[model samples]
Target: VGRIKTAPACSHVPELPEVETCRRALAPRLAGRTLTDAVTPWPRAAATPLVVTGRCIVRLDRRGKFLLLRLDRGWLVIHLRMTGRLVVVRELPPRTTAAFQLDGDEWFCLVDVRKFGRAWQVARASEVVGHLGPEPLSRHFTAARFSAMLAPRRARLKPLLLNQRFLAGLGNIYVDESLHAARIHPLRTANTLSTGEVRRLHRYIRTILRAAITEGGTTIQNFAGPDGKPGRFRSRLQVFRRSGEACGGCGTIIERSVVAQRGTHFCPHCQRL
Candidate 1:
């Protein structure tokens, strides 16, 4: 057997943009293809395998950080908790937790070094993924709506943004970048923001997510498209992981702090409480 390849340690979780990228890359290749077999070496890695086998993948969709593979009978929902990756390759790579074989000899592999990935098959997609917040990129997520959503929350800004139930799809990198762009402190209370601050935050959140998607999402570690290509958005990041570097907006030294239990980065001069 050829040497097994493995993904590197991931610094960030697979968020909205990354998950959406995976859906887009896999949809074309997987849609209409029937699953001849489904295998999970780590039994806990997949659930309801009987429902997945022999089902044709009709489409692939994404919500927050989850990928939904619509099948003829049910949906297969995948969550790459931290370091999981789904790739379609001629040969499987190392650390494969689960795999699905298509009728055409093609294979879809789930390689997760940390074994944190999970998959579920259910008759109703909503049963497994219905609780997620509104998609940030959707037309339903207007500035007014976002402002209204924050009006009653008393949590800190960074933590609130990280809540999948609050805004779905924003992880650490984009949250930090959006907070910096909006010139809002990560620790600012959610309900304390003025209408203008809320509007700016809303706008930047959508803007940053769109830009990242256009660039195929940021790849901090181990993230790649279904085709095994790394994302390019990291090159366009302004504040994330740039601690101690000159701020792009005001030349202030970027600083790092612990907020919401995650490493937070921002420009001390640009983003203030």
Candidate 2:
């Protein structure tokens, strides 16, 4: 629920592919415009204030899945929670539950029914720089770096991947899919993966993420690209919430279990420890 509380602030879990997806969705809208105005109706509520009013949106980029709005003065970083989606096509009506909105992205709406998403209007880049880790697809997020992150922690691998500080932009769906892809148990100790397994893990992370993005980001709930079509990727998902169904690869009945309290799915025979 804590993660969900950050939902309105969540932006597609900022995965390598989702970040790229958001970049595509937001870039065209912001390319030649300036965030000429900023306001927050509820100042004390969880919100991102207008931080760089006079600055033009220099570049729209992503560090992991978090959308970074580079301005001449500072930055605006957004993390869309479970229901969080960065849209570009319409001026949506004010959701009774919307947390906030940024005018720059044609319509930046933080619409989480549970009010879990957040926005940061920042005058200083340092505000969020300390919060995110290396991009999984960046040249620096190597096997060596992935391996090193796990060496010191005794935590279960699943939750560790969900931790932004550990390595930003992974979430329940990708964690489940990646673990199953690597054929590793979700409960495996972070430090125990072999070099080969780590290599497979890296490959699977990108593959699953990129595949999901190509299909328009999974919409098991509220995710949708600028087109408003539901994400088709959920139909292609291998094991996330596919319990009681045949595994796509081996036809074994997929199963569900608890790992770090997040209900998880995997093919028992294909994803054994």
Residue range with the least summed lDDT across 10 consecutive positions in model 1 = 3-12
Q: Distance (Å) between predicted and true CA of 131, model 2?
A: 2.8
Kindly list the per-residue Cα lDDT of model 2 for residues 115-200, writing each as its tens digit.
Answer: 44456767766587567877776778788888787778888788888887888777888889998898887877888888898888
| Candidate 1: segments with Cα more than 4 A from true spot | 1-12, 222-227
lDDT of 2 at 132: 80
Judge candidate 2 at residue 211 and give its lDDT: 89
Local distance difference test values of all predictions, in order: 0.83, 0.67
Cα lDDT for residue 28, model 1? 77
Top model number, lDDT: 1
Using Cα atoms with residue i matched to residue i, what is each candidate's TM-score against the true structure?
A: 0.92, 0.83
